[model samples]
Target: MPSFLQVAVLLAVVITAAKGAGALSKRLGQPAVFGELLAGILLGPTLLDVLHWPVFTDPPYLERLTRDLAELGVIFLMFLAGLETDLEEMRKVGAAAFFGAVGGVALPFLAGTALGLAFGFPLYESIFIGTILTATSVSITAQTLLELGRLRSREGTTILGSAVIDDVMGIVILSVVVALHQAGLAGAGDAAGGAAAVAAGSSGSTAAAQGADAGGAGALAVGLIVLRMVAFFAAAIAAGRWLLPPILRRAARWPGTEPQFAMALVAGLLLAVAAEELGGVAAITGSYMAGVMLTLVPDVKRAVEERLAVLAYGFFVPIFFVNIGLETDLLDAVAASGPAFLVLILLAAALGKIVGSGSGVRPFGFTWMEALRVGIGMVSRGEVALIVAGIGLQEGVISQAVFSVMVVMTLFTTLITPILLRWSFGRAPGSPSGAAAFSPAPGPRSGEAD
Candidate 1:
């Protein structure tokens, strides 16, 4: 591990770059996060390759620390977002958000799968591509909206709501594909060994038995994943509705520095851990839920809002954005894939969210431009796509080429969403319905789970 001295230097560099770049970006009329993210890319292999510097080289110790810290940033941002969310306002746009998310998820999945197959990839691989495309990391969007002071707008609420739904759908879809991939491997292995068993003359049933076992296992996994998802939602909502309020209410009376506020932060962290370890969902999901649940209590919301905003926006959240750029390698993969290939995959990933989500919300109360903004906001697949791509690579369900393309797509989408959102929201007309719901600048994807 790096010494504290070294760690301090690393932290200083990351924070300085993030804040400095953010300021520059704001001056350029873009979101500060855009600059923070761009700064990360500049610090990474795309330019300086900072991690390879002598200071950070201990078999990824600093690298891991950076990721963990970035992840914490993501959690903080999402938690604050939850605090700012107006439940009643979200409810007003619930159907539109739901339908929009459904469309956002469905169309990209189909398009990605078809594109994979068109290139002659295998069945499971094709499905995995579709699944990868289904992710909609809303972290960038949430931050951008916060920057623009639009977090309380109708479009903002709807986008936030749709992201939650989008993540659940994406996670569930990934689970199904993972099961199928595992089962396919199991069946293939069994079949390969079947001839040997047949030669032994005592095991005509070997292949059948193993196939049955594999099928059962696959189905069991998918079932458990779905069950866990359902259980998490139920428990989170129930506890938020009942359990948390009293605990927080009591905490509010304590002499500690914003005791109830501290408790709320703890609850968010605990739920974030649970979301990953038990709920079979992203950690951000839990944190965001914690924020949402805490919002029901006026005291906790007031306290947390006062305390968390500075910590999140001032420090951690910028790291979260910067770390995204730090982790990316935008050129190598794109250069290898050729222009036509890049354009095809990029278009498939981008349009899926834009066309699907946009149309989904348009049928409700949104204007065409507003719907377009919603679609643009959902385009960045963020960190979740990287997770899915990593899994596919580990399972041998996608080639390095495919994985690289995903990385490139993720980079493009992440870099573009903030800019697109600013453009789209800028053109959108202001109104009282959305304006009245405005709360403090809370920040989001179900994000870095984004």
Candidate 2:
């Protein structure tokens, strides 16, 4: 545990940094996340250590403390993400969003996995690498639509709906990959023991036979992991619908309205933790579901969003990005990936999202040009992609080289989104819904940027 003074100083740093960076980003016409990421990089090993900050070198606890606070940022982020989801709207554009999200996740993941596998990555690593490519930060695209005042239009609805699916599907893919990776690691451990038994055996035949058994066991382990994940998700879905509502309703009637937010936060985190404990995918799944449920209720949703935004912008988010910067070994990540690999990753990242999302919505009767614009609109990746990549790197499923490649991919995609939205929509003829224009992408009607 950190000392009281240490915690206080760390909190102070996060608030100052986030606010400063956010203001700068807004001024530069960039998304606040860009500034946050930049702030993190500046405070991290790359810059602070390079400049020889005494605090970084002398106190190990400071770094860890920063990380802990930043993690809270991630949680708050997910809470907000959940709050943004609208199930009724999602239902309206279900087909387009479903296909768009599926295609978007599928292609990039496959491309990434294939690249990793071709480079001699193990199966689990390849799968994880691919999983990193799954999420679309629809927030970026939504922002563009908002600037253009097209957010409430059909295309806007389709994009938002698809983005939600994108998040859910991305989490599912990540979970499946994690399950497989865990199984593989366990199997490898078991195989090591089997190999030792063979080495001590009397004959070569016995060694070969043992190796075969180990392989079979590895396959079985993988199967069991998949089964476990399926069971966990099924239980969660049932519980969310059948059990959570009444509990939330009861909590809503309690003494303080603040408890409603508390209940939702507690429920979201618990659900996430439960999912992870059960070998299911992203912990944020529970958070997202909680958001969906809270929105369904008439009175509680506002309080929940209010509390989440306050906590998010106030402290947690800045700390998270700053810690991300501190932990980043940028040179190592870049050196491992190399220029050629980086280029390939970038191309695949852009093409995968554009092609997948663009094609998916066409059957919904959107004009081909509108579909292309939507695809371009959705192409930029953001926080979700970074989170996914961070998970893969932390799990040791991807080397620093692959992780670096992902960072570059994220940077390029995010940086280009505003420009693309501006250029594409600016040329279109004016429409009442503002779907026809591109320069001023839509902003959220909720007026809650936090």
Candidate 3:
């Protein structure tokens, strides 16, 4: 086992490096996350290999500790994501955001899966690749719009709303695909060597029997996956609605300062545990649900968010982003994938979101330019994609090299979005093609930036 001192020192190095890098990135007018990712690469095997210096006798134990911290970062990061979800804003954006998210999700998923198949990946792995491509992070776009004094514009609002819905959709799809992949694995195990069975089934009747058995197994797996997912969502949502409110309301009244914070954290942890053990979904999904539940309470939302941000960002979130780089060997990943897949994946990742999201908003009364703007706005992929990629790696759904390529792809999308979004909005508002108008849905908070 690695000594606690080694772990502490490693964390110190990581946190300092991440914070400094994040500050520099912010100075360059990019988000702090950009710097944090870059720092991870620099500190990882690609450069420093901080996790494997001569001082630490055992590396895996240290790795385990860091990974555990990183996992906490994911939970809090996702929980905050839930907190940011403005339901009222989504309601106002209505069909525009909904269609935008649907299109954003569908096209990317199809395109990514098709690309993976063309590249000779298995069906389940291909689906996982598609899932990786379906995430949208509008944080860069939102910040850009804020800088351009258009954060409250209809396109901006819709992009934010669509992003929120996009996250939820992405999570749901991830769960289903993961369950499907696991089910496939279980069926394969039960087969006890399919090739041997196939060779033995020489007669037509024997072969037919084998086929029927296989078909039956496949059908059962699908049915079970669907039922589990449905039950989880139903129970989780019901708990969020009925169970959470009463618990939180009581916590709000408990003795001691910010008792609700502890209670809320407990709730998130329990839900996260339940999500994996019972719901068969990621723990972060449950945390996210907990966050949404907290949002409903209204009374404790501020307290929880305020306290959580410090704990999350100051430590865990940075580690999570950095650990991504730490675990990735850029040169090996690139070599494994080759230049062609890298370039193609980048293309698929960007175009899938742009075309899918852009076209999705057009029929909903959005002008072509506005639709184009929305598409461009949704182009960035951030933590959501990274989290999914991490899970894919953990579940053995994707390779380390592919994971590294995806990390590179995500950073590329994030960096390029601000420039693209700014250029998209550069056209004069009075121009013929620039007829995008702020038609907020009927509400008191309409036209507000999410």
Candidate 4:
């Protein structure tokens, strides 16, 4: 088959699988994202590969195409992620979210670093482990809340607010790590490679000669990255707020709003491209900021959201989730880390966010129980963790083994979140148990307005 035709056919199958699985998950009282993830695992090397699903057995370039489609999914997902955030509500929970983000990052890094020292894996791998733990998959968490009709509630708002902050902080950390990894500093490469560098840097003239260059390069790279990121964001936000509204206002008056779609399309694509070219920032991130800034114009915001939703959820989101499954290599993680380490990493991954983000709510006047609930609510790692893990694998910062553990971690946390939340709110006020009577009724998809 022609390449484009092959991709189209493969995506159709994957979406059918994801949608069926998603429906099944919702029927079972779980989030659709959970089903989508499960679909990935099943279609992956673990089981259904024997059935010869195209994505599982595709050639490299085809796989690359699938991944590119998936990247678009990520962008749309991030855009919706930006849309769902409420800055005003976040301000109320700001103190707690800030602390939570800090603690979430710190504890995982420290614990992972210490574990690496003890396990003999070297520092870089340890950092990767910690980085994996640092993410709070906002999509999964929001899905859970929306399912329970809690997305509009106090606790839901708090958790959502905290998650946005957590995500922003996570991206910043990723930027730094990616920059360091690229510059051949921060232990050079993976566990084996980094160990060699550490040894040479400690004892060899070669290491000494390269140290200054690595340090200088890393510094310059980080500086350029920060400046570019800031500039892109500043420009997008300012233009979005100051310039976009007037332009959109005029666009609305045009004879055909199909033109509005074109404008929106151009705006999203251009903003995304600009962000990448100018600052090396994820285009989705920049696009999301653009969305957020323009949210004040309700009519324009609603129109863009309506058009984007059909494109995003219908096509891109499913593509992204399915790609996650295809990329997962569960056996490798088990082989590398061994069972015991796997168990430890999973536990740390689950608890790290809970303790960090949960405890940080104390200064924000939330009850201990409320804080705990928020922490548990945020436990679902979902797609973003997998995205980071994929990046780590491609960069060779983590072996297939670590990536496998992350897949397991991501799936486990996502699967269990709804059950956990339901248990905690067992017949309590504002739980999904009370969902039927929720003021704004729950929608078919997560985070969609009634």
Candidate 5:
């Protein structure tokens, strides 16, 4: 465990650097997140290692503490995002959102898989790499749009809705890919055991029986995973509709906002834990669902959002963005993967999202410029990408070098997304028409940026 003093000092440095960098970024007309990310890189191995700094190098405990805090940051950030989402807006753009999400996921996945294969990676590795490319982090884009005062516009809502759908699709794909990989491993083990038993002429029947059992188990596991996911969403939605609103309403009457905030936070955390523990879904997804559930309660949504934003944006969220940079070693990653590989992967990531998502929204009556704006908005892959990459690294599916390359790719995409989105919005035909055009029946805090 890290001592209190060590943790405190580490946080102090992190917060100071993050805020300073963020301020600098704002001065440069960029989102504060960019500066925070850059601050993390400067304080991390990329720069600190050269300077022999101990902030990230000499203390394992500090690193762990930072990671834990960062995870909390992401949970709160996602929860806030969910709270801010306009379900009515999403409904209006449902067709466009669905197609955009599908195209965004499919094209990137296929392109990434093909690239991985071209690089001579194993089948599983290739698939995992492809999976990484499917994630879309819209928070950055949302912030940029908010800065440009276009977040409530039609294109903005479309991007937000599509990004939400994109996340759902990405999680489902990840679950399926992971399950399939496990099944493959089990089959390989069974095959090896069966082969060995047959060579020794020692009870091939037992090996065959075990292989059958293993196969059955794998199938059962996959089935259960799918079922769990369905059950989790069903339960969350049901609770949101029937249980949570009343509870929040009651909590809203409790003298001050603290009670309501506490109730919301507890509910969000509980659902998040349950989602991961019982449903085997990502905790962020659970938290996001919880936020969405609360959004249905028009009376208390703004209070909850206002209360939570102070804690989230003030501290935890910045840490999450910065932590992404701290964990990545850009130079080492590029050196190991080769500049060509990095450049190719980066290009693939960017174009796959822009073209795929852009093409998906064209049939929805959006002009080419509007579709391009939506596509550009979905190009930033932040927390979700990092989480997926981290899982892959932990499971030994992707090497450290690949993980580093992914980190750099994520950072690059995140940094450039705001600039690209701003440009796209500028070139987009027509002025910002506010939220009324997209969602006439605004849910609680619906038009706020994620």
Candidate 6:
């Protein structure tokens, strides 16, 4: 464990670096998140290990603490995202968003699977790789659109709605894959046990019973995951419609904003925990739903958002972004996977989303150019990709080389999304010359519609 002094020093260094990098990135006309991510890479083993920093040389408990806090930051960030989503606007683009999300998910998944198989990976690993490609992290895209004053535009609304649906689909796919993998393992174990029993000349009943039990358990696990997901959303909607609003309204009337803010935070945290523990869904999803619930009371929604934004953006959110960078060792990853493989992986990640999601919105009457913008917007994979990759790594479903490639791909996509989004949106209809038309400005804060 790290001493108090070490922990304090780490926080100070991380915060300072994140803030300084963010400021520089903004000054350079890029998103602040880019700078924060880079700052982490510089301070982490990727660069700082060369200097033999104590923090890098001897792993400290502070690193774990920081990781946990960073997770909280993600939860808060997603909560804010949910709060900012305009339901009314989402309703307008519902059909387009649904189709876009489906197209986005299906195409990338198929491409990723085919690529992984072509690279000689096993069927399961290939499927997981494809699963990783299916997520769409739109925080970067949303920020870019907000900056361009297009977040409230038709395309923007569809992008945001589709991104949410994309996340849900990704989570479902992840659960299914994990459950199936577990079942496969159980079947293998049963086969091994049966072979041993036959060699020993023992009755096979015991092994058969064990196999039956294992099979049943695997099936039950999958069923529970699905049930929990349904229950969570159903409960969240019910609470939002009936229970939460009165409590929030009553809390809003209390002296000062503390009571209301405290209520919102507590509710969010509780829901997030429940989602993970009971619902088997990502905690960020729960927090997001909580934010959506809170939005039901419009009068206090802005107040809650304003106060929470300070806590989130001022500290936690930046740490989350930086922590993503710290987890990666890019040089080693490239060495292990080979440059050619890495390039292929990156291309698959980028092009899969573009083609999948872009094709999805075409039927919604989007111009080809507009569909392209939506596709590009969906290309940036952020925390969701990282979380899924981490799970795969922990479960030994993905190799270290694959994990590293995913981290690199996630960062690369995030960095280029804003530029691509800007370029795509800058091309106005009927403009003769395709010169850049949009001037980037600090738009509405992250998560808010323009």
Cα RMSD of all models vs. native, in order, equals 4.7, 3.6, 4.9, 4.7, 4.0, 4.2
lDDT of 1 at 189: 72
164-270: candidate 6 lDDT, tens digit per residue = 78876887787667656765776677667767876888667876776677678767766777787788889988987798778877887899848988998988999
TM-score to true structure, per model: 0.78, 0.88, 0.91, 0.85, 0.86, 0.86
In candidate 3, position 304 carries an lDDT of 82
List, residue by residue over 119-220, the lDDT tens digit for candidate 1.
778888889999999988766787777766677678887898898778767866765576556656765675656656667674657757865776676567
lDDT (CA) per prediction: 0.76, 0.71, 0.83, 0.70, 0.78, 0.77
In model 1, pairs of residues that clash are 447-450
Lowest summed lDDT window (length 10), candidate 4: 441-450
lDDT of 4 at 252: 72
Query: CA shift at 3, candidate 3, in angstroms?
Result: 1.0
The candidate scoring highest on TM-score is: 3
Question: What ordering of candidates by lDDT runs from best to worst?
Answer: 3, 5, 6, 1, 2, 4
Q: Give the lDDT of residue 355 in candidate 1.
A: 97
Query: How accurate locally is residue 218 in candidate 6, as Cα lDDT from 0 to 100?
Result: 64
Each model's total of backbone clashes: 1, 16, 0, 2, 0, 0
Query: Candidate 3: RMSD over Cα atoms?
Result: 4.9
User: In model 1, where is the ten-residue run with the lowest total lDDT?
Assistant: 441-450
lDDT tens readout by residue for model 3, 1-450: 359888888989999988888889878987677888899999999999987799888889889988999998898888887876788889999999999999999998998899889888888888899999999876677666766667778998899999989999999999888888888887776565554666766676775677678769888878976887788879888988899878877888889987888888888888889888888888888998888877776667777877887778888888998999999998998899888888988998888888999999999888988999999988889778899999999999998988999999889998888888878888555433211333332111100111
Which digits, one per residue and each the tens of the lDDT, describe model 4 over residues 185-234? 44343334434786766556655556666656557766777787777777
TM-score of 1: 0.78
RMSD of 6: 4.2
lDDT of 6: 0.77
lDDT of 5: 0.78
